[model samples]
Target: MSQNSLRVVWVYPDLLSTYGDQGNVLVLERRARQRRLDVQRVDIRSDQPIPTSGDIYLIGGGEDRPQRLAAERLRRDGGLNRAVANGAIVFSVCAGYQILGHEFINDLGQREQGLGLLDVISTRGEGERCVGDVLADIDDRLGLPPLTGFENHQGITHVGPNARPFARTRIGKGNGTGDGTEGAYNDTVFGTYMHGPVMARNPHISDLLIKLALDVNALPPVDDRWYEALRNERIAAATQPS
Candidate 1:
């Protein structure tokens, strides 16, 4: 988290880069650089070891097989947990989100252990997948605007006492836990189901990540007019999708 540069690690792109979740990293890098902050972006594939040197780490959505493989590889590699222990920030989506928890149902329908970075537990839900637009109110504590994006996961994640919900679902089945919660966050780990590459649809969230990573109260402003316009358009559609 140096003023000279911030390292952003993209984890398991070969496996977990689904649902345009890679945009989260792109937006993070863009915002930082636009503010004249240097960024060292590293794409760490599934086969390689994750590095603890990063200030922020990003994981994306993927199918069951890739998710299972990524979880296994990460748990074995041990760098992610070490990074978290060192206070590095993490943002994950869908399958990436699920595998950050204590455990998740794998492609074989067997229980696969997660990194335990998040205290939640994940299980594949029954019936239909939770797909299409999502509209949610972010946790009041974050004091952010409404969340608008897309959800297409069968994951039913239960937030344990150690963690809290990231948002409340106004539309679409988030977490599919029947609790109307959309995501989970604890300490430095954050996970969500919404995909419009999420941060691209909600630039404030990107700013939050940057601030947290830099351990700063605020970030230098970057142009967000385009991001705001997209967020407004999506929120309207999610509220009145026809």
Candidate 2:
């Protein structure tokens, strides 16, 4: 565990990558390189044993059956819980978000157990799928930029008192029918439904994760003017009057 080296565990990509969530890992790798850090990505599949510890962990969206299977595998493995206890930063998206909770209602209308990593629960909605661009305000204490990403999910999540909402939604449906809140957060663990491989669009979030992984309060700056401009443009379009 050298200070310059970071180990990132990509958890079950084969099962939970329906929304191109691997791009989130790519964003983290690229950001670490920009800051002269060495990043090693470990992909944990269904057949493999999850590493006991890592600097960061990424989990992605998935279909109903795969999500259930992945959740069961993770629960049986027990490595992720150890890593989280050791302060690893976890970023999960969409179905991954749901699976981290105590339980999630599947597409078949049956309740399934989850990993119980986050103090949250998810249930299917009755109307149209909540799919579209999303805008959210990050916690001010984090010093991160406002978040913008694409969300496509039907599970309405409710955060418990032990955890906090990751962000407040400004546009589009978030956790529980766009109740002005987006995701769930507890310590270094983050669960969100914003799926455009979220980190790719929100570099500050990536940096924040990196900071946690490295156990540092600050990181070397990287110019993101282009990304900022593009993100702003997209946010403007998404927020426009319909």
Candidate 3:
């Protein structure tokens, strides 16, 4: 990792400014700084050229209308797909997640086409919000702690035949009732409903993403030492929830 050369882009307006989604960008910036990596932030909107490539791409959650608008703009731009093809690590949360898929049905009787960057599909929300702590039992390869975060979305996501469920919800409605699904992950992209600026305290996941981006870009992974200390702290926090 160069001491001053990591480029990260966040898709704009169509982006969800609410719910502290920008915090994810801040988290990545801080973590990269700790590792001596320079972080550059960019925002792409309807009129701008979607960056051809970046180390990471982040889109935060938003209301249904904005979600639809963002999805439409992205679909029109077609640059998002191109960037993904060029090997950009993409992470979308809540509405952002929905927009990445083939389609999403909102609480209203409306259907919006997703960017199809991901294989998962989402159905119309049940008007019931799933807001609470989310726990996912990810395997060791993911190198993540059992996570706890809040969910406040009404959409019921269904993983497509080609997708993988990232986590199972232990405290809120995930994929289905009872044995509900939580989050989805494919290649280097991850979609989850957890908010509270999830990435801030979840540096392990951030590291995983940074590593994935570097790997996809054919760059060496970020050194483990910078992330190890934070991972241990998060693990301890997970084990003893306050």
Candidate 4:
């Protein structure tokens, strides 16, 4: 681990603080440190330029209005798409997921196009806001145990022609249909609605994300033992009712 290797950035357009998505960034840093990887964090605000060199980029969840506002800014600035195109592993959650796609329409009759990095569309409308601990049976591509996390989104996501669903719904919404829409992964980019600061508590997914970043850097897989341990503990704890 050297000063040059583990640089990661958190993009802050709006509501990053409100939803506590910053916790995900902390989780990434802590895990990286545990693996003896060097770490740097850059938080990008509206007026600031997004640095292109980071290995990973994080975008957190926010309110509907703020989501739209952030989308407008990123659409105008064009830095986010460039980072993704240049091979940075980007992970966006909830509203962040919505903005990474082609378009999003929230429950209040608001509609806006997103960065169009993915071939999915999100629309918030009349539906139960799926909340609480969620479970997704692991698909073969992820190659991890089943995923569990918190989901709080009014948006119903429908994967477009070019996209694939990351997990099938076992507990909550997986791909926006009644079966549930858990997340989407395309190449090195990951998007999802789940966040208990998802990567903080769910390190298995974090490892998957790190693998993507490592692929970009042509680095070998760092040991993922911690991710396995955390997943086992979280699953056991989840099984015990409060």
TM-score for each predicted model, relative to the true structure? 0.98, 0.96, 0.84, 0.86
Best-matching candidate per lDDT:
1
Q: Against the true structure, candidate 4 has what lDDT?
A: 0.75
The weakest ten consecutive residues by lDDT in model 2 span: 138-147
Question: Model 1 lDDT vs. the true structure?
Answer: 0.91
- Candidate 4 TM-score to native: 0.86
Give the residue spans of candidate 2 off by over 4 A: none
Error of 3 at 124 (Å): 2.1
Give the CA lDDT, 0 to 100, for residue 82 in model 3: 88
- TM-score of candidate 1 versus the correct structure, residues matched by position: 0.98
Error of 3 at 238 (Å): 10
- Model 2 collision count: 0
Q: What tens digits encode model 2's per-residue C-alpha lDDT throughout 110-175?
A: 898887889998999888898888888976667678889898878899989878888888888889
lDDT of 1 by residue, 1-242 (tens): 57758899999999998788789999999998887888999999988999998999999999999999999899999999999999999999999999999999999999999999998999988888888999999999887899898999888999999999999999988889998999999879999998998999988998888888888888777777898889888888888849
RMSDs, each prediction? 0.9, 1.3, 4.0, 3.1
Q: Which pairs of residues clash in candidate 1, taking residues 3 or more apart in a chain or in different chains?
A: none
The sequence of per-residue lDDT tens digits that candidate 3 reaches over residues 91-202 is: 8888888889888885355888888888888886556677655556654457567665667778778887777777765455765434567668888778887785677656
Return the top candidate by TM-score.
1
Off by over 4 Å in 3: 1-4, 106-108, 176-178, 216-242
Question: Which stretches in model 1 have alpha-carbon errors above 4 Å?
Answer: none
Please identify which of the two predictions, 1 or 3, would achieve the higher lDDT against the true structure.
1
